[model samples]
Target: MILADTSVWIDHMRRREPELVRQLQTGNVVMHPMVLGELACGNISNRSEHLRDWGLLPRVEEAAHEEVLSLIESRQFMGRGMGFVDMHLLCAAIGHGVQLWTRDVQLRAASVECGVSFTETA
Candidate 1:
């Protein structure tokens, strides 16, 4: 299973690239609540439609606030600014035991440092 990150979703939603379209069409993409929240920040209102289009319901997970906080602190200590959404997504990925699919280099690097599995593409 793969946790589709907001960046890739945004690219798929706005650009409709054939590659992203094909990847998402494969029925392997899943999402967390944080990704839904980010999508909500955009113009999307039909949550069901997005979920259907993405091929999975939100894979809900318990809040790992402490671990997420630790990750944020570590990233800050290492000079990266507070990446709140990225940390939340990472927390969700860790909880779900799935690889995070994101194009954000910093988040990918931080995921490595935190021992979270992640990938740049679907």
Candidate 2:
């Protein structure tokens, strides 16, 4: 399964990204809690519909909080501009053994640096 980040979700909400739509339809995509929270907090017009759609996908089980703190303290991503949520997403993706699908450049870079599988293109 692939863990789709918030950016991809935003794009899908706005324009119906073909690949993401296909993945969602096939149940090949998993949702990250942080990504869900981000979407819920966004100014999305079709909020209820989007939430219901996302609710159907399997959610990535929550990663250890300590792991996220460790990543932050590791300082490997010191200047990468990744915040706690990004690190949390990375940690979850790693823990879940899922490829991360994202459009955020910094998140993609961090994923590469940390050896997490990712797809930047649709």
Candidate 3:
């Protein structure tokens, strides 16, 4: 499983380099709900940009319920609190024991605690 971060997704949606984009084609690609929300949260300057990447979101089976719940309550998110969807995605990746392809700095950092791998590909 792979989590596609907002930064990479936005870059792909806009610049769209064939080689770089291919990284997303083969794997069990996904976007953490937070990553999705972050992209969607962007303003009209690139609303189409956000919408373009929506198709890439992947579907994974449910993860260990507690792993997800603990992650949500973890300090990793600080006072910001984790969203349920994000925890599901993160937990699913961890439960599956696969890497998440992303460029989200925070998510990458959180990857350590989540027990999922994160890869940065150009």
Candidate of highest TM-score: 2
Order the candidates by lDDT, highest first.
2, 1, 3
lDDT of 3 by residue, 1-122 (tens): 56655566677666764544565566557655566667777663567755665645564556666777776666456444435555566666776666655555556666666557565444
* Stronger candidate by lDDT (1 vs 2): 2
Residue pairs of candidate 2 with colliding backbone atoms: none
Give the candidates in order of TM-score, highest first: 2, 1, 3
RMSD of candidates 1 onward, in order: 3.3, 1.7, 4.5
Which residue segments of model 2 deviate by more than 4 Å? 120-122
Candidate 2, residues 1-122: lDDT per residue as tens digits?
88989988888878879888777778889988788898999998977998887887899987788888888778477667887888888888888888887788888877877677566453
Report how far off residue 42 is in candidate 2 (Å): 1.2
Better of 1 and 3 by lDDT: 1
Lowest lDDT 10-residue stretch of candidate 3: 75-84
**Positional deviation of residue 118's Cα in model 3 after best superposition, in angstroms:** 2.2
Q: What is the TM-score of each candidate against the true structure?
A: 0.71, 0.89, 0.56
As for TM-score, the candidate ahead, 1 or 2, is 2
Return the lDDT, model 2, position 106: 88
